[model samples]
Target: MSLCEIVRLEGYIQSSYLAVYPDKIMLLDGCCRADVPMVLDYIKTTLKRPVTDLKVVVVTHMHPDHAGGAHKFREETGCLIVSADKKKQWYSGIGGRTMHFVDIHLGYYVARRQGRPLKNLYYSASL
Candidate 1:
């Protein structure tokens, strides 16, 4: 069985999950982009592992709160970002585009709070 930890983010009011395996860890949601440090701290202090030990980050949904920190996490940990293998049509339509735009804008705040600019974002869709 895998061990699960709830990564609590400040002000966001959403809980992210971290699954610990024998040799690696997996993140269920990226949480808020601004909360990257908190997530990393949990891994280091509680999980007692280097951030590099994280192997996968699964964005449960395209919502900003869910996938917001994915790109940053990937850059810091070299973990693979995973989403649904099938891109929902909603993800390519105007609504999806609008949401993505919002996410990008929100990332700016996160970057500022973290005192670092966010890198170019990318995601790998897979099962």
Candidate 2:
């Protein structure tokens, strides 16, 4: 798998793109709740590299930073985004589901499990 970092637009969010194969790619985190183009530029460049073809965008859960770029990426790259089911509904503009948020403790736990320091914890919802 290959990973790429795409910084979000100022006052926006951050994102990461993962390419599992030359013909497949999944977006780990998205730029923000709305549209953010800088992140898009990052991914496009990465795909253009004669390396990998980004085909899918997957998010770990809901939240703008992780879920925001799904639609745009799909439109731009013709990539399909697979997100946590609950989040998928939200992005479809048919919002009527229970909204739950992530906690810092769980975040810390995840970081620890990854052998990362808790204080250095950061997340891109698109994991």
Candidate 3:
């Protein structure tokens, strides 16, 4: 068993990563969706799982925050990227990633006060 951690991205976007093995990495939010730039990967690597050794990438939603980099990860890690909604998983590569649309409601919301796409914009450097 390896270590697991919930990496907070730009905003509400959170990605979880786990190192089931020293050389095996499980990216809960593999899409670079949050655009944390190695935050999650760092955590995973800190647990002895380097990106090169990674073999599993998991995407939570179709939103950019969770599916933006789905294609990149698959190319780099050569790992099986898992996600939901076949249409949502867009990647120009073979065995890019796995998209499995689960039958569950994940509460999504937009901040009425901020009037921004808070629902998916986590790493918003816009001020």
In terms of lDDT, the best-performing candidate is: 1
Off by over 4 Å in 3: 1-12, 31-36, 39-45, 85-127
Q: Candidate 1: lDDT of 59?
A: 83
Per-candidate clashes come to 0, 3, 6
> What is the overall TM-score of model 3 with all chains considered together?
0.47
Ranking by lDDT: 1, 2, 3
lDDT of 2 by residue, 30-81 (tens): 4443333554554467346321255667766556556655666666667666
Give a tens-digit lDDT track for model 1, residues 1-127.
Answer: 5555444444243567777776788888776665677788878997789999888998877665677678888999999988767646335767767767766666566556767656533332211
TM-score per candidate, in order?
0.66, 0.47, 0.47
Shift of residue 21 alpha carbon in model 3, Å: 2.4
lDDT per model vs. reference: 0.69, 0.48, 0.47
By summed lDDT, the worst window of 10 consecutive residues in model 1 runs over: 118-127
What TM-score would candidate 1 get against the native?
A: 0.66
Pairs that collide in candidate 1 are none
Residue 2, model 2: lDDT of 48
